[model samples]
Target: MNKWRNLAILTAGVTMLAACTNNPYTGESEAGKSGIYGGIGAVTGAVIGAATSSKKDRGKGALIGAAVGGAAGGGYGYYVDKQEAQLRQRLVGTGVQVQRNGDQLTLIMPGNITFATNSSDISSSFYPTLNSLVTVFKEFDKSGINIVGHTDSTGSLALNQNLSNARAQSVASYLSSNGVAGNRISAYGAGPNQPIASNATEQGRAQNRRVEITLQQMQ
Candidate 1:
């Protein structure tokens, strides 16, 4: 299934590139086509990390994708299924939680394992685990990834936002340096605005202080 999806992407990209060889590119100029393909690339990106996202957020991601008319041709779900399976297999016993929704997958790394108290620095203990994950990502290059930072309400709103942003940047930077293309991965900080637990309790706060990385299916 991966081979098929990879082939499809390669074929489309090659065809688009070959179009430049034709004479009289007035109606099909490189500039126009490049813009369209770039839009499709955006769709490819948004499709990642949106499956487990909130409905509103997922909708926004889809809008970014649909506006460019980018799609993975057909059988996109199957391609994603294979990739998700591979990811789950690789992440076994890594202290990372893998969640799936439709053809998208999210990697939830709790703050306990991902970072220190009020720090954005990724722990050295987490390096080996991330290396394993990056090995899979390098193989499955078609998917787009989004890294989101979340925090509990223990700090000021401004501080929480900054912390969240920095944490997200840390993860995204790590992934980029490890092999994920910079263009296909994005980072966003939700701060305290999008908490999954009550801020009144230690347990809830622990759960809220986490990072989520979503991978969209290839298109």
Candidate 2:
């Protein structure tokens, strides 16, 4: 399955490159459609250029970078899966739902689990879950993780966005203090922009308030 996904991504990259004729802004036309893996010439050019940092070898860097980036992305995905499996048990009682899709892991935390009305602080009851999550972060390899805070449409858009952002930052800070690298994590507050359910009802409002943790590629 992993192999197939990689192949599919590669094919898409190729097709995308092929369809591009020129960069409108730069007025530069790429020499090859499949910029990274189409041939040995492209590879050689990319490598030499990247290694030497010279115009003659620009192609080499491009080729090497592409190959490295793709492999790294795939390898990181595999690693995330392994880590998620190990952390799944620890996360079970956190009032948070975990969803895994291929190389991605999403941790959905209900508002009641983490904060008070229109606030960003992680509630006392949330300590166990937050602490457990931090422990998991400490054990896992460092990677780019996004902490996204969301809210139901209960207030002004500006207020919601700020609160959401603050919540995400709080979560990020907790993890960072617990051993996760600060630089590897990003906080985002998308107040009411993305809700799992409508805010028309109490249940839906509860559903809309959440924190989303997205594990990105490792450095």
Candidate 3:
């Protein structure tokens, strides 16, 4: 009986590993990570269930555990996929670049479109774009919003950091005022430390001086 149990556990481990490797859901992307996690959860749950159940009912317990674990692990990935689709549809031609990395979604608002030169105040013309974002954020309350302010390397480090911080706060405050829960939002300033482009040219500087809002799943 012990030998059979050991064989069953080994079989489950091998099967899950294989499934994860070949699974369409698994990959280096966020969606793929979700699949790998789901596979791992399934394997872990199956092992636990089988070990805890009577010898005669081990298989049934394992199956139930696998089902539950897989569902739990994949739920967030599904949620992110839907949210991404909605954001892409809403942000069309709005000058907000929607980026997906792993399980997070980032909306990159160019400095030119969101604010005036060296100012933290949001431009009046960007209100509608922000309002659209607020709508989706409210609908998907399960995610946390991280507003990060960034700047070019033209300014002194202190000045750049302060400006970035203020800008991040401005955006965070706007989102909060527009009805996104304050508790679900955080603001930070990255200054010129994390530039997406070389700040040697005007165009590169323009890209660097921007605001990024990233959506992350809440536990």
Q: lDDT per residue, candidate 1, 89-189, as tens digits? A: 87888879987665578999998998999999999999988888788888888889889999999969999999999999999899899878888889989
Instruction: Please provide, for model 3 over 60-156, each residue's C-alpha lDDT reduced to its tens digit, 9 standing for 90 to 100.
Output: 7787777777666666766787788899888999989988887799999999999899899899999999999999999999999999999999969
Residue by residue across 25-136, what tens digits does model 2's lDDT show?
3578744222323333333333443555555544445556545544443344446646776667778666788786655778898988789887888898888888887777
Candidate with top lDDT is 3
Full-model lDDT for every candidate: 0.72, 0.70, 0.83
Compared with the true structure, the alpha-carbon lDDT of candidate 2 equals 0.70
Cα deviation at 138, candidate 3, in Å, is 1.7
Residue 217 displacement (Å), model 1: 3.2
Compute the lDDT of residue 141 as modeled in candidate 2: 57
Between the candidate structures 1 and 3, which one is better when assessed by TM-score?
A: 3
For TM-score, the strongest prediction is: 3
Q: Report the Cα RMSD per candidate.
A: 17.5, 12.1, 4.2
* Candidate 1: clashing residue pairs, number: 1
Candidate 1 colliding pairs: 48-216
Q: Rank the candidates by TM-score, best first.
A: 3, 1, 2
Runs in model 1 lying further than 4 Å from the true structure: 1-74
